[model samples]
Target: MPTVRSVTDATFVDQVLLADGLVLVDFWAAWCKPCRAMAPVVEQFAAANRSRITVVKLNVDENRETSETYGITTIPTLRAFRGGREVASIVGALPRKALETRLRGVLGRGAAQGPID
Candidate 1:
């Protein structure tokens, strides 16, 4: 199943910014409780929206440049990019429904479930 993948500063451009469609990036750290809490939801969302979106994770500790460039002052920051441009962002821990709502809003209609790649 398609799921979240780990990304680093070096690969941020090609893996995210230059990607074709919607890409949800989870900027997190190992020690962050909220980030850990949201992991599974992100995975499930990725699996469900495999065709519409690509999900990825970036560890702040390991990728300082990317984090700093994005001005990620908080862990668990979820940034959504579409067509090589950042479109939305969310910070902190949120429930599954709320996360889904946010993603749906960003995705803008067309509710269909497809197996992730």
Candidate 2:
């Protein structure tokens, strides 16, 4: 099955900010149990929407710069970005249904445009 990919502080701009579609960024840490618990839900979402949306996970412990830039105060925070700016954010380890609802909201906001490099 398809899965969420990992992005580092160095790659965040190219991988997410400049991406061509909706991107769900999962802020997480290796030692956080909630982060681990939500991993599968993210991957499943990614797999199901592989053609329309992109899912990426950023390790907060390792990518402190990106995490701080995004003001991530909690693990498992899910942020939706399109056209170089953040459109929505959810902080916490939400269940699959809740996450899906968030994705639907993000997708419903219409299409994104232009390259954001």
Candidate 3:
């Protein structure tokens, strides 16, 4: 089973931005209802796309610096990074199809062609 790894301030750069491959980072807070609701969706999405992408969670409460740097005012902000640059972002809880569409666009048809290299 796939799980969202909690990232902290200390490891933010290495875990998210500096990482290779497509990194989907979810910026959220524990107290936020929307964030809580989106957790399962993210996990499921990660499980399905484990070979194509890297999904992670960053707690705004614990990683204030990164949250502020990213200008993440929302409780649940999802960002997709490729080659250390942010390529796309979405806020709020989105349905599975919508999330897949966005990810597919980022990963490209090459992703569906075969398992991630």
RMSD of each candidate?
5.6, 3.9, 4.9
Q: Tens-digit lDDT track for model 1 on 1-106?
A: 4488999999999999888778899999999999999999898888878888889999999999999999999989999887666777889988878888877766
Q: Over 4 Å off in model 2, which ranges?
A: 111-117
Q: What is the C-alpha lDDT of each candidate?
A: 0.85, 0.84, 0.82
For residues 1-117, what per-residue lDDT tens digits would candidate 3 score against the true structure? 446787888987898778878889999888999888888889989988888888999999888998999999987999887766787788888887888876777776332243321
Query: In candidate 3, where is summed lDDT lowest over 10 consecutive residues?
Result: 108-117
Segments in model 3 whose C-alpha atoms lie over 4 Å from true places: 109-117
Best by TM-score: 2
Those runs of model 1 whose alpha carbons end farther than 4 Å from true positions after fitting are 109-117
Score candidate 3 by TM-score against the native: 0.87
Rate residue 39 of model 3 by lDDT: 88
Q: Arrange candidates by TM-score, descending.
A: 2, 1, 3
Q: Enumerate residue pairs that collide in model 2.
A: none
Q: Which RMSD does model 2 reach against the true structure?
A: 3.9
Structural similarity to truth (TM-score) of each candidate: 0.88, 0.89, 0.87
